[model samples]
Target: MFRFLNIVIISLITSIVSAQGYYDVTKYGIPNDSTFVGKNAIDNIIQKAVQKGGGTIYFPAGKYLTGSIKLESNITIFIDAGAELHFSDDFDNYIPMVPSRWEGTTVINFSPFFYAYKAKNITITGRGLIDGHGRNWWNYSEGFDDKKPKSKWENTFFENNKNVLAPPDSKWLKRGFLRPPFIQPMYCENVLIEGITIQNSPFWTVNPEFCKNVTVRSVTINNPHSPNTDGINPESCSYVHISDCHISVGDDCITIKSGKDEDGRKQAAPAEDYVITNCTMLSGHGGVVIGSEMSGGVRNIAISNCIFDGTDRGIRIKSTRGRGGVVENIRVDNIIMHNIKQQAFVLDTRYAKSTIGPVSERTPIFRNIHISNVTANTKDAVFINGLEEMPIEDVSFSNIHLEAENGFDIHYSKNISLNNVFFSGVKTSLVKIENSSDIDLKYLKLEKSTEEKPWVSAINVDGLFIDGCRPKKGTKTFLQLSGKTTSNIGFGTNDFRNVSQVVVKDYDVKKDAILK
Candidate 1:
C-alpha cells in the first residue's frame, strides 16, 4: 500500500512538472560537480529560457557561488538534493542599485539576491540550500580578520540604528541599519517556493511583498537570531498558502504585515486570504505575528496545526492608534506552546511612537478575532488593550489551558467571551476588564497556587456576566459595581439596578449601596 501511494504521488508531481515545462541549468554552463565557477553560465541559461518563452532552470547536485540574479516571467528554479547556491558577498558585484521597491515605494536600491518583479508563474522548488553568506556582509565594515569567531555577526543588533536606510548612500559605507532580505520577490503573481533550506540572512528571510497567488510549502528557514531577522514575512500579499515550514530566527518567526502607516493606508491594499498550517517555531519574538506596521489592514487569515517553543509571545497582533487599519476575521487553532515568556495572545492597538495627536480617520480598528484549542505555559494568558477613543470589539477565546504567572489584563474593549478557559495564578484576578462592556465568562476554573498572594476581584466593566464559574478559596471581594445611572434612585444593595446589566451566577457577589 505504501509503495502504491508513493507511486501515485510521484506520478502527480511528474505530471505537474511536465506540464510546467522543464529546462536543465547544466545545459547553460551550470556544473554538475562542485568545482565549476558557473556564475554566468546558469545566468545565460535562465536568459535563454526566458527568451525561448519560459521554462525551468534545474540546478543538479553542486555548490554554486554567484552574484545577484533576476528571475524573469514563466521560469522555475529547481535545485536538487546536495545543491547549494551561495550568494556573493562582494557588495561591488551587486551594482547599479537597480529599480526595486522598498517598503511601499519603488526606488533605486540594492536588489535582492534572488528577485522577481511584476513577473508571473515563478517557482523555486526542491530540497536544496540557499545560503546568504551574511557574515561577510555583516562584517563588511567591522574589519574582522579571518581568525574572528564565525558566529560574531549573529550577535549584533543592526535593525535598531537609523543610519542604514534602504538604498544606502554608498555601497562602501557599512550602514548596518538596512536589513537586506535574502530571498525577496515583489509585485509578482502565481509564485511557489517549496522544499528548500534557506539560511544565514543579513536581514529578513523569504519576504514576498505585494504579491498574489503565492504558495510556500515544506521549507526550512533558519537564521542565527540576529536583529530584524524575521522568517517568511508575507507583506501586502493575497491568496497565500504557507504550510509545513519550520522557521527559527531572531525576530518574529512568521510576521504578516501589509504596509506602514499613512503610506499603507493611502495604498488601501489589504493583505488577505492567507492560510498557515503544519509549521513549527522554535525561538523568536512571536510564533505567528500580525504587524505593528500593518497600516493597509489585514483580514481573513487562518493559522492551524502549529507548535511554538521558547518564544516571547504566541499569536500576537500589534498595531497603533492613528495607523488607520482594520484587522478582522482572524482564526488561530490547534496550537501547542511551551515556555512562552510573555502573554499567549496580545492585541495592542497603540504600537507606534506614542503622541497626543487628534484621532484621525486613519486610526486602526480591531474586531472579530477567534482563538481556540491552545495549550500554553506563559507569563500572561491574554493581554488586550485598545485605545479609549477606538475600542476593540467582538473577541472570543475557547478551550484554552493557559498556565500563566500574571493572569489576564483587558482594557477598553467590548463583547468578549471566554469559554472553557482555565487559569492557574495567585494574588491576581483570574480576569480583569477595565472600561469595557458586554463581557462574558463561562465555565472558568481559576486555581490559586499560593496563599499569600490571594486572588482579588478587582475587575471593573459594564454589562459583565459570570456564569458556571469556579472561584478559588482565597478569592477576595466577590464583585463590585460602580457608576451612576439616573437621578437619586438607587434600586437595591448588592445589586446594580440603575446601571447596566451585570449578572453573576453559581457564586456569591457583592452589591453597592443605593444612593438617592
Candidate 2:
C-alpha cells in the first residue's frame, strides 16, 4: 500500500546489537517437507545466529509446522515470498506459562504464539504468511456459545491467581489460562514487523507490550469471528508508528492500551507518541479503539488517511471509573467509513460499572481530542457520554458529514464545538445535549421531515451558542430548551427563513436564558 516507505532500513536489522550473518533452516537438516516438528531445527539456527552475535534466519518457500518460537536479540526472521510458518493448535505446546500481560494484568500464562523478552533490534518481515491455527483455541474459549466446557488449564489458572486479580474485567478468571497474542515482543527496543500476512490469531494479533521504537507496516491480519482476536494492539509502548496495514479481525481493528486498573497504576507508563495512517479496515468492532484498559494513560496520537468498511465504530475511546487514565491530544482526520453497524464515533467514560467513588486517581479522564474531515454511512452516529463528576472536555469536530438514522447523543461533556457539520437521513432529532455547557454549533445542517418535534433539544445545558446555521427551508420551533439549569443561550447571525418560531422554552426555563 505505502510502497515508498515499504522497506525497513537495513541498519535496523543488522546494527545496534552485533555482527550479522545468514543461516538457512533447510541447511540445518530440517527438510522442506512441512511434517517435521521444526522447533529443534529453528532453535539450532537461532543459536548459531546468537553465537555469531546477530543474523537473519531464513525460511525458504515451503510450510514449517512449529510450536512457540522465542526470538532473541539482534535477530531477524525473513520468510521468503512463498514460505509459511504454521503454528500448532495443541494448547500444551504453549505451556509452562510465561510471565506476560494477559488483557491488562500481569500473569503467568501461555507463551505468546511468537515471542521475545527484553530483546533488541529484532525484525520479522518478508512477503510470507504466519498462520496461527486458532480454531482449537477459539473452540476452547469463545466456543462457550456452542455449549462447550472449559479446559482443565482454565480451572488451574483460576485456582492459582484468583486471589491476586482485583479486576474491573473480573470475567477473565472464568475463561482462565488466557489466550496468547499472535506476536508479542515484551520489553524490546527497535522492533520492526512488516510485509507479513497473519491469519487466525489465538488472541490479539501483532501485540507489542512494553516495547519502544516499534514500527508495523504493510501487514495483513485476517481473523474470523472468534473471541478477543483483535487485529493490532500496542500496549504501554512509546514511539510507535503503524501504517499501510489491512485488517479484518473478530474484534477491534487497532486498539491502544496502557494497562489495567491497579497493575497499570503501579507501572504508570503512558503510551505516548503514536502515528497511525493509511490503514484499511474491513470487519471489526471499532476501526481505531483506545482503551477500556487504560489505567496508566494514553496521549499524543495522530491518525489520518484511513478507511473503515463494515466496522462497528470509527473512533472509539472508552474507560471506566476504576481505570484512572487520561486520554488526550488525539487527532483524527481524513477518514471514510461505510456501513457502520453502530454509532460511528464514541468517547465513553463510564464504560464499566464500578461503585461511583470519589474523584481520585481511579477516575478516568478524556480531553483535547479533535476530529475532522470524516464521512460515514452508519446506523447511528456520535455517542459520547462522560462521567458526571468529571466530564469530558475540549472536544471539537469540524467538517463532518454522516448519513445515519439517528444523530448526536452527548451527555456530561463541556467545551464542545461542532463546525461545518451535516447530519443527513436523521430519523430522530438532530442533537440531544444534557448536563453539558459551553457548546458551540456553527454551520450545522440536518434534514428533517415531520416538523412538530424540535430539531435541536437541549436540557440542563449552560452557555449554548448557535451561529451561521441557515438553510432555505426550515421548520417552526427549531430549538427547544428546557430545565432550570439551562441558561445563557445565544444565537448569532442565523437565518430562520420560511419558519414561524425559532426558540421554545418550557415552564422550567426562564425567558431571559436565551439571547439572540
Candidate 3:
C-alpha cells in the first residue's frame, strides 16, 4: 500500500511539472507590438525553458519582430494561429558569423533566420507564419548596380568584410552577394518542423545540413521568382522525411545535395534514406532535383505520389565531372507532371560550368535508378546525357506515358531498360540512341508527329534490343542505323505500319551488325 502511494505521488508531480512548462512570451515581457525587437527576450525565454528541463515557448496572437533566433535542444516554439514571426530587415542584426554552408560550400557566414546547432528533439510547430521580410536582401543581391553607390548597411558591413560576404573563389559572386537561408539546422538530430507557413526567403528555404532523422510535414513554402529560393533542400543529411507540403519557389522545389566540388569530396557524407511523398510543386526549376553539388554522393532515395505543375523540369539529376560522387538506388513511382517546360526526365552529366578532364575520383556516377508509373506532358520526353569517359549505367523505366514535343535521347549510357513506356506528339525521332550499349526496349509505343525522321535511330550503339515496339501508321523509315561502331542490334516482333523503308544505313558498317 505504501509503494502504491509513492507511485501515485511521483505521477502527480510529473503532471504538475508538465502543466507548468508552458512559457508564454507575453508573461516574459515580450510585447505583441510589431515594432519591438524580441530577440533578446525570446532567447531569455528559451534559456529559461531549457533550465526547467525542456518546454514549449508559446507565442500568443501577436506580430513579433525579431532577428536571428537560435534554437536549443528539447524545446518547441509554438505560435498561435494569429501570430506572426517577422524577421528584421537590418543586415547587422545577424552578426557574429556562424559555421554554416552556403550553396554547398562550408563557410563561416551570417546565421540563418532560425538557426539551430547540434540540437536534439527540437521542433518548430504551429499554425502561424514565419516571414523573412527578404525584399531588402533580395534587392541587395539582385538589383545592385556596380556604378551606384552602396547603401549604408552595405557600405558598413559588406564593403568592410569582402571575405565574409562572398565564398572563397565562388562563381556565385558574379550573380550577387550571398544571403542567408530561412531556416537551417546544422548537425542536429530528431528535428521536426510542421504546420507553418514560410514566405519570402532570402535563399534556400528549410535547409537541414548534416542532420539526421529530420521530419518536415504539412508546411507551406511560398517564395517568389527570385534567385536561389529553393523550397526544401536536404544536404548531406540522412533519414529525412518530407510530406504533405506545398512548394512554389524560384529554383528547385526539392533539391537533394551533399557538398560541392572539392569541399563536398572532402566531407564525403551522402544524403541517403529519404522518403518524400504527397507533395505538390507549383512552379520551380525542377520538381525533384539531385545535385549540381552532390560530390559527397547520394543513395537510397524514394519519392512518390508527387505532383509537378508548370515546373521547368519534372525530375532532374545533374552533376558535372569535377563533382566526384555516386548517386545510386533511387526509386520514383506514381508521379504526375503537367506543362513541364523542359524534359520530363533528365539525367545530365554536364550540369553547370564544370567540364570534363582526366577521369578521377571527381567523376560523378549515376546508376541503379528505377522510375515507374509516371505520366507527364512536357516539351521533351526524356534526355539522358552521360560523359564519354564515365557513362551513366543501370537505369530502368516502367509504365511511363509521356506526351512531349521531342522523344527520348540517350547518350553515353549503358544497361537502360524501358518497359511499357508510351510517347506521343514527338516532333523528332521516336527514340534516339547515341554511343550507348546494352539497351532493352519492350512494349514501347510511339505516336509520331509530322516530322520525317526515322522511328528509331541508333548511332554508335551496341547490344540494342527492341521487343514489342509499335510505331504509328504512315512512318517513312522504321530504323536508321549510323556510325561504323554499331554492332549486335536486334529487332524482335516489332510492328512497322506502312513504313517506306525497313532500314536506312547512314554510314558504311561491317556485316552482321544488324539482326532481325
Per-candidate clashes, comma-separated:
2, 0, 1
Report, for every candidate in turn, its global Cα lDDT versus the true structure.
0.73, 0.87, 0.87
TM-score of 2: 0.93
Determine which window of 10 residues in candidate 3 has minimal summed lDDT. 159-168
Q: Write the per-residue lDDT of candidate 1 for residues 26-99, one digit (tens) a residue.
A: 65666665565455676687887887788988888888877677788988888899889887776644543554
Q: Report the poorest 10 consecutive residues by lDDT, candidate 1.
A: 485-494
Instruction: Give the higher-lDDT candidate: 1 or 2.
Output: 2
Clashing pairs in 1: 324-362, 494-511
* Candidate 3: tens digits of C-alpha lDDT, residues 1-516: 999999999999868855777788988888888879898899998898899878899988989999998899999999889999999988777866578888788766678998999999999999999999888888878766766765554443345345543324575554334688999999999999999999999889999999999999999999987888999999999999999999999899999999988888888999999999999998899999999889889999999999999999999999987779999999999999999999899999988665558889979999999999999999999999999888899999999999988888999999999999888877788689999999998897775523388877889999889889666667678778898889898888877666668778875665779874
- What is the RMSD of candidate 1? 7.9
Cα deviation at 433, candidate 2, in Å, is 0.4
**Over 4 Å off in model 2, which ranges?**
1-20, 143-163, 166-169, 447-452
The full ranking of all candidates by TM-score, starting with the best, is 2, 3, 1
lDDT of 3 at 427: 79
